[model samples]
Target: MSDIDRSPKAPDLYVHYCEHQGCDNWGSWGKSPSAAVATRWWCFEHFPHKSFDRNRR
Candidate 1:
């Protein structure tokens, strides 16, 4: 088989940091309900959506 490159690019290597101010945790969870809504990233502690209450605001 011919040689091929399957490495992740620079953007792919980027780590999304928590959007919360003064927080530097890795943003592993993100929400983007619709195209019009901007994506919000946050760590487990800062994620607004809780397991017990999805509609809590």
Candidate 2:
């Protein structure tokens, strides 16, 4: 085993695109367990409007 901190890190450089139908933004928000959100991903622009309902309240 190796000692490493693999926790989530901030997105400084371009990682990936949002999983929205036709979005072209970088995916800043996403699920950890992979079974929470339907699309499982959304950019900082669309997450609040789409995944909030399922995640919060």
Candidate 3:
């Protein structure tokens, strides 16, 4: 058998899919300034709205 037979199939990661459910918009790495939140892949619609801080003007 050839070495190719032993190789594992690569996963089809729709890697840029938005973190939000039911939302298929293209996504990218997202983050919040607050230390309490973890960074994750988010779409353009949600990326600017993720916030942990309550105090705002």
Candidate maximizing TM-score: 1
Tens digit of lDDT per residue, candidate 2, span 1-57?
Answer: 457867587768747678878998888786553455354667877776644566555
Q: For residues 1-57, what per-residue lDDT tens digits would candidate 1 score against the true structure?
A: 447856566555878999889999999988876688888899989887764255433
lDDT of 3 at 43: 82
Model 3 clashes, total count: 0
Instruction: Answer with 2 or 3, whichever has the higher TM-score.
Output: 2
lDDT of 3: 0.66
Candidate 3's residue-wise lDDT over 1-57, tens digit each? 776685477878766677888988877856655578765667877764626334322
- Which candidate tops lDDT? 1
The stretch of ten residues in a row with the least summed lDDT in candidate 3 is: 48-57
- How many residue pairs clash in each candidate at the backbone level? 0, 0, 0
Quote each prediction's TM-score: 0.61, 0.42, 0.40
Local distance difference test values of all predictions, in order: 0.79, 0.69, 0.66
The segments of candidate 3 whose C-alpha lies over 4 angstroms from its true place after superposition are 1-14, 32-38, 48-57
Please report, as a residue range, the 10-residue window in candidate 1 with the lowest summed lDDT.
48-57
Model 2 spans with C-alpha error above 4 angstroms: 1-14, 33-39, 48-57
Per-residue error (Å), model 3, residue 43: 0.8
